[model samples]
Target: MLRSRVAAAGGCVAALGLAAALAAGAPASATDRTDPNDRYTAEEIHHFLEGFYGNHGPRPWEREHLVSDRLKERIAQTPGYDLLLCAQNEPRDIEVGEVTTAQSARVGWATITTHWSQSPRTAAFTAYVDLDGSRPLQLLDVDCAPGD
Candidate 1:
């Protein structure tokens, strides 16, 4: 399960017009696209993220990304220490929409529309992931406009 905070280098661009406030990283190939389901399958990915968000149930790619000692400590000590956590803990149902590829063949973003189960208003966000065969699939970034 993925547990690290996303800080992209080149920035993550969302088709929904939300620029992911992440570390801007390598330029993504526009021509290279793959089905997110080919790796983790859409159903599995949806279930995984839902499981992770509700009640801090499961952590995604928690082991593969913890290459350094500091990262390990960070997760162990502060699971709810960042925006990602704040978003995850929202009192809303995480509704997964379309899943599309981004930077690499194995990496893509999921369109999620969310609102409290009791509320009528809804906001949308994209949750990016890395599902390469070399490592377990993980949630790379969770960018949401809480009020949008």
Candidate 2:
């Protein structure tokens, strides 16, 4: 169960555009493309979060980007911290409310609303997606926060 959740969370991180952030050191693949929709799946969000909390690692989502070399060093020092903190634990439940898309010749953006659930508690968040949907769906970025 834990393994499945961790894999799901990793997949979610990859889906959430964090893969690009994490893959900063990886070589580019010929098959790699930047389309937000292709990269993000509504269902994947739930799985990712599930894995995040399940593992008890540091959270990339907790701090936005890896930032400077210092932060990267911190991240590296704490192996699997991000994955364990963010993917292994469950945050109650998630409700993807509505999704809206905006586009131009060069790029595109999507706004999605989601709800989070935990025993005796519930919260909401919104995600903003920017990527090249015309070619393939890849996450550019996301903004999320608690909602009422």
Candidate 3:
């Protein structure tokens, strides 16, 4: 699926000085995990997806580390694409666009399209979160591309 693959090669490093250049460079209190208001917001989803798709690291307050091992391995073996000025350079600045949520007997999730890269590259994600408020947000799936 597109979502799963989004976590794949987006994390690779490149040739020449590009790799080193790309290698360069938050939070609230809460044991209130049980609090009803402690639901997963787009902020949390974007933070998680940032790591999953952009090859970025996890943000603070994230409960689990979710980078896929296969993705990591692929990134290591393949040359990373350095063309994403917005995606690779200032990934954190990328914003979450539209967000919608749903649940089934099996799972609950939020479907989102993020402003991800610059003018073109964008991402769609289905991130699952615990509505019962016992756990933190997780990316059930994610897909990214260069245009609409």
Q: Output the number of the TM-score-best candidate.
A: 1
Q: Report lDDT (CA) for all predictions.
A: 0.51, 0.40, 0.41
TM-score leaderboard ranking? 1, 3, 2
Evaluated at residue 114, the lDDT of candidate 3 is: 44
lDDT of 3 at 7: 52
Choose the strongest candidate by lDDT.
Answer: 1
What TM-score do all the candidates reach, one by one? 0.46, 0.32, 0.34
- Candidate 3 Cα misplacement greater than 4 A, ranges: 1-92, 105-132, 146-148
Lowest summed lDDT over 10 consecutive residues: which window, candidate 1?
1-10
Scanning candidate 2 in windows of ten residues, the lowest lDDT window is 106-115
C-alpha positional error of residue 28 in candidate 3 after TM-score superposition, expressed in Å:
12
Evaluate model 3: give its TM-score: 0.34
Error of 2 at 39 (Å): 14
Residue by residue across 1-148, what tens digits does model 1's lDDT show?
A: 1333242322343522333322454454322332433455555466656654553322455544522344345446555644444344554565666666543466656666666557696666666666553444566665655533
Task: For residues 1-148, write the lDDT of model 3, one tens digit per residue.
Answer: 8866765545442343455655642133554333345555444444545554443323433323453344335334435532222223334333344444443322344344445344665554344433433454444433334333
| Clash-forming residue pairs, model 3 | 3-142
